[model samples]
Target chain A: MHSFKAVFKRELKGYFATPIAYVFLVIFLFFAGYLTFRDGFYEIRQADMRAFFSNLPLLFVFMVPSTAMRLWAEERKSGSIEILLTLPVTIPQAVIGKFIAAWCFLGIALVLTFPVPLVVCYLGDPDEGLIISGYIGSFLLAGGFLAVGTFFSALSKNQVISFILSVVACGILVYAGMPTTLDYLSNILPAPAVSVIENMSIQMHFHSLLKGVIEFRDIAYFFILIIGWIAACSIILDERKAS
Target chain B: MISVKELRRTFGPIVAVDDISFDVAKGEVLGFLGPNGAGKTTAMRMLACFLAPDSGTATVCGHDIIAEPVAVRESIGYLAENAPAYGEMTVAGFLNFICDARRIAGKAKKEALDRIVPMCAVGSVYHQTIDTLSKGYRRRVGLAQALIHDPDVLILDEPTDGLDPNQKHEVRLLINKMAKDKCIIVSTHILEEVEEVCTRTIIIASGKILVDSTPALLKEKYHCSLDEVFRKVTRTKKSA
Candidate 1:
C-alpha cells in the first residue's frame, strides 16, 4: 500500500513537472472541441452524445499511447530500471500503481471535454443517462488502450519502438470485430474463431457501454484484459531477472 | 554483510561473469577494481539482485539473493550509472519519488529528506527539473535518491564516472563519511581511490578474479607500488 501511494504520487508529479500533461490536454481538447462544436455553427443533432462518446474511443487509440509510451520504456532505455528493480517494492505493485496513475490522468483529460456535454445540454434537453453512460464507456475504452500501451512499454526499451508497438497493438484491438475484417477471415477461419474475435474487440464493448447499459460482462472484459496483459508484463520482467 | 560463491553469468555462449566469489563485512569498503568489460558492473548487478546468477548463489545480510530479492533490495542501496532519474521530475520531486518507492514515510521520510538534502548538496537545485540539471548535479541527485532510505548495504557503479575534480573529491569524501555503519561495494577504474578509501581491493580481468587482497599486502606480494600492482594484475596474460 505504501509503495502504491508512492508510485502514484511520483507519477502525478512527473506529469505536472513536464509539458506533456499540458500539451496532451491542449491537443485532446482541441480535437474534441472541434469535433463537438464544428467551427462556430454548432449542429450536433440528437439528444444522445453519440458525437462526443464515439470519437473518444478513436482518440484514445493515438493519444493514450503517446502518454503511456514513455512510462517504462524510458526508464529501461536510460538504465533507471536497475534502480527500480532493486527497490524494496514488488513488480506487481509498481506495475499496478503506474497503470492506475496513467488511467487516472486519462480520466482527467476526459473530464476537460465536459464542456461538450454541457453545450449539448444548453442546446436541448439531452438524455442525462445517455451522457453518463457514454462517459463510462469512454473511460473503459481508454483504460483498455492504456493497458495495451503499458504492456508494450514493458517490452521495448526505446520510446519510439514502444510507441509504434502500442499503436499497432491498440489498432488490432479496435478493428478485430469489423465485418469487413471478419468476413475476410471467416472464409478461411472457423465460425467460432470469428465469434471469439468479435467478443474480444474493444469497439464492441464500448458500443454497449455507450447505450447506457454498463453491463458486468463488458466491465469484466476490460478488467480481465488489463490484468492479463499486466501479468504478461510481470512475467517478462521476472524471466529477465531469472536469466 | 555480503557473500558470494562461484557466481557465473553467461549470455548464450559467452561468459560475462565467471566463477567469482568474495565477502564484504559490515562497515567495510571493498573497491571493485577492473577495466572495461572485466565484469565489474555485472558482478555489482548480481550482488544487488538486479540480475540472477546462472550457476551460483549469493547472499546479502545472510538472505539468499536469488531466493529473497525483496529482502536483498531492502538491505541494499544502489546508485547506477548515468544518473537516471525521470526527466520530467524536479530534484526534490525525484528524491521524494524514490523515498516513496522505497516506502520511507512519515517521520522517517522527513528525517531522510533533511539528512540527504545537504549530504548530497541538492538544495540549490531542489525544484529545478532533472532534465535541465547539469551532469554533475544530476549525479548528486542520483546519490541523494540512493541514500534517502539509508539501507545497510551500498552498491555504487562508477561513483565518479563523469564528475568534475571537485565533484569527485566531494563524492569520495561523502562515501568515506557514510561508511561508518554501512557496507559499501564500489567499482571504479581509478586505482588511486582504492588505496585512499577501501580496506580491501580486488582486480578482475576477463570475467575472472585476478587478485584479491589488502592494498599493502598486494603491493608487497608483487614487490611494487599500487600503480604497478594494478598494471601487473590487469596484464592480458595470466600467470601459470
Candidate 2:
C-alpha cells in the first residue's frame, strides 16, 4: 500500500513535471469544444453532446497511447525501473497503482472537456442519461487503450519503440470495430471469426454506452481486457527480474 | 546482518557472479572491491533482492531473498552507481516518496525527513528538481533515500562515484557515523575509500572472491597501499 501510494504520487508528478499534461489538456479540450459547438451543431441539428462523445474514443485511440506509452518505458530508459521493482511492493501493487494514476490523469483530461457538454445542457434540454453514458463509454474506451499501451510499454525499453508499438497495437484494437474495416474483413474471413473479433473490438462496446445503455456485459469486456493486459505486463516484467 | 551461501549467477553464456559465499555480522562495514563488470554489482543486486541468483541463496535478517523479497527489501537500503532517482521529482518530494514507500509513517516520517534532509545536506535544495540538481546533490538524495527507511543493512554500489573532494569527505564521514549500528557493504573501484569508510574489504575477480581481509592486513600482505592491493587483485595479467 505504501509503495502503491509512492508510485502513484511519483507517476502523477511526472506527468505534470513535463509538458505532457498541457499537451493532453489542449488536445482533448480542442476536440471537445470544436466537435460540440461547431461540428455537432451542423450535423445533429441541436446543441447535443453526441459529437463530443463520438469523437472521444477516436481521440483517446491516439491520446491514451501517448499518455500511457511513457509509463514504464521512461522508467526503463532512465534505469529507475530497477529501483522501483526493488522497492517493498508486489508487482501487482506497482502495476495497478501506476495504471490508475495514468488512467486518473486521463480522467482529469476527460473532465476538463466537460464544459462542452455543460454548455449543451445549459442551452437545451439534453438527455442527462445519454451524456452520462457517453462519458462512461469514453472512460472505458480510454482504459482499454491504456491497457494496451501499458503492455507495449513494458515490452520495450525505448520510449519511441514503446509509443510506436502501443499506437499500432491500439490502432488495431480500435480498428476492429470500424464498419468499413469489418466489412472488408468480413468479405475475406469466415463470418464466425469476424463476428468474434468484432465483438472484441474496443470501439463497439464504447459505442454501446454512447447510446445510453451501460450494460454489464460491455463493462465486463473492458474489465477483462484491462485486467488481462495489465497481468500480462506484470508477468513480462516479473520474468525479467534484475536483482 | 547479511549472509550468502554458494551464490552464483550466469547471464546466458557469461558468468556474472560465480560461486561466492560470505557473511557480515551486525555493525560490520564491508567494502566490496572490484573493477567494473567484476561481479560486484551482480552480487550486490542479489543481496539487494533486485535480481534472483541462478543458483544458491541469500538471507538478510533471516528473510530469504526469493521467498520473502518484500521482507528482505524492507530490511535493506540500496544505492546503485548512478544514484537512481526520478529526475522530475523535487529532492524533498523524491525522499518523501521513498520514505513513504519504505513505510516510514506519521511522525516517524517527519523525523526521518528532518534527519536525512540535512545529514544528506539536501536541505538547501529540497525543492529543486532532481535533474536540475548537481551530481553530488543527486548522489546525496540517493543516499538520503537509502537512509530514510533506517534499515539495518545498507548496500551502496559506488556511493561516492560522482562527488567533489569535499562531498566525498562528508559522505565518508556520514558512512562512518552510520556504521556504528548498521552493516554497510559498499562496492567501489577506489580502494582508499575502503581504507577510510570500511573495516573489512572483499575483492572479486572474474566472478570469484579472491580476497577478504581487513585494510591493515591487506596492506601488510601486499607490502604496499590499498590502491596497489586493488590493482594486484583485479589486474588480469597473463603469465609471460
Candidate 3:
C-alpha cells in the first residue's frame, strides 16, 4: 500500500513537473470547447449537455492517450525503469498507481469544463441527473481509453509510437459500434457476429450510461475493459522489463 | 550477505551471464571488473532483483532472488548502470519519492534525508531539476537515493562512471567508509578503484569469472601492476 501511494504520488507530480501537463490541459480544454460549440449547441437549443458529451468519445480517443503515452515509454527511454523495477514495489502496484494517476488527471480536465454546465444551468433548467450521468460516463470512457493507452505505452519505448498505437486501438473501439459501421458489417456478416462486435464497442456502453439510468451491464463493461487491459499491461511489463 | 549458486542468464543465443557463482560476506567490498558486455551489469542486475537468472538462483541478505524478489529488493540498494533517475524531478523531490518507496516516513523520512543529502554532497542541487544538473550531480543524486534506505547490501554498477577526478575520489572514500559493515558489490573497469576501496576483485569476461582474488595478492601473483594483471587475464581468456 505504501509503495502504491509512492508510485502514484511520484507519477502525478511528474506530469506537472514537465510542460506536457500544461500543454495537454490547454489543448484539451480548447478542443473540447471548440467541438461543442461547433456542433451547433445553440441550434440544438437544449438545456442538456448533449453537445459536450457527444464530442468526448472522439476527443478522448486522442487526448487520453496523450496523457498516458509517457507513463512507461518515457521511463524506458530514460532508463529510469531499471531503477523503478528494482525497487521493492511490484509491477502490478506500479502499473495501477500510474493508471489511477492518469485517470485522476483526466478527471481534473473534465472538471475544468464546469463553466459549460454552469452556463447551461444559468440559461435554463437542466436535469441534474442527466448532467451527473453524462460526467460519470465521460470519466469512465476516459478511463477505458487510458487503460488501452497504458498497454500501448508499455509495448513501446518511444512515446510517439505508443501514442499512435493507442489512438488506433481506441479509434476502433469508438467506431466499431457506429450505425454506419454496423450497417456495413451486417451486410457481410451474420447477425450474431455483428451484435457481438457492437457489444464490444466502448461507445455502446458509454451511450447507455449517458441516459442517466445506469445498468449493471454498462458499468460492468467499463470495469472489465479497464481491468482486463491493465492486467495485460502488467503481464507485458513483467515479461519485457529485463529486455 | 550475498551468495550465488551457478547463476546463469542468457539473452537469446548470447549468454550474458554464463553459470557464474560467487559470495560476499559482511564487511567485504567486492569489485566487479570487466569490459563492455562482460556481464558485470547483468550479474549485478540479477542480484538487485531487476533481472532473473535463467537457470540458477542467488540469495541476498538471506532472501532468494527468484522466490522472494521483493524481500531481496527491500534488503538491498541498487545503483543501476548510468545511475538513472527521473530527470524532471528536483533533487529533493526525487529523494523523497525514494523515501516513500522505501517506507521511511515522518521523522524517519526527515532523518534519512538529512543524513543522505550531505553525505552524497547533493545539498547544493536540492532544488535543481535533475536534467538541468551536470552529469556529476545526477550521479551523486543517484547514489543518494541508493543509500537512503541504508540496506545491508549495495549493488552499484559503475558507481563512478561519469565523475571527475575529485568526485571519483570522494565517492571512493565514501565506499571505503561504508565498507566495514555493508556487503557491497561495485562494477567498474577502473583498476585503481579496486585498489582504493575494494577488499576483493573479480574479473568477468564473456559472462564468466576469469579471476577472483584480493587486489594485493593478484598483483603479487602476476608480478605486475593491477592494470597489467587485468589485461593479461582478460586477453588470455578471450584468446582461449
Kindly report which residue pairs in candidate 2 clash with one another. Answer: A242-B51, A243-B50, A243-B51
Candidate 2, residue B231: how far the Cα is off, in Å:
2.3
Candidate 2 regions with alpha-carbon error over 4 angstroms: A36-38, A240-243, B236-240
> What C-alpha lDDT, on a 0 to 100 scale, does residue A214 get in candidate 3?
86
TM-score of chain A of each: 0.93, 0.94, 0.99
By DockQ rank, best first, the candidates go 3, 2, 1
DockQ computed for model 2 against the true two-chain complex using alpha carbons: 0.76
- The two-chain DockQ for each candidate, comma-separated, is 0.65, 0.76, 0.90
Q: Lowest summed lDDT over 10 consecutive residues: which window, candidate 1 chain B?
A: B231-240
Model 1, residue A60: distance off in Å is 1.7
- Looking at model 1, the pairs that clash are none
Ranked by TM-score from best down, the candidates are 3, 2, 1
lDDT against true structure, model 3: 0.93
Q: How much is B79 displaced in model 2, in angstroms? A: 1.1
**Per-residue alpha-carbon lDDT of model 1 for B21-128, expressed as tens digits?**
889898788989887888888888888888888989899998998889889988888887676777777787778778877878889889999999999999999999
Give the range of the ten consecutive residues with the poorest summed lDDT in model 1 chain A: A36-45
CAPRI grade, predicted model 3: high
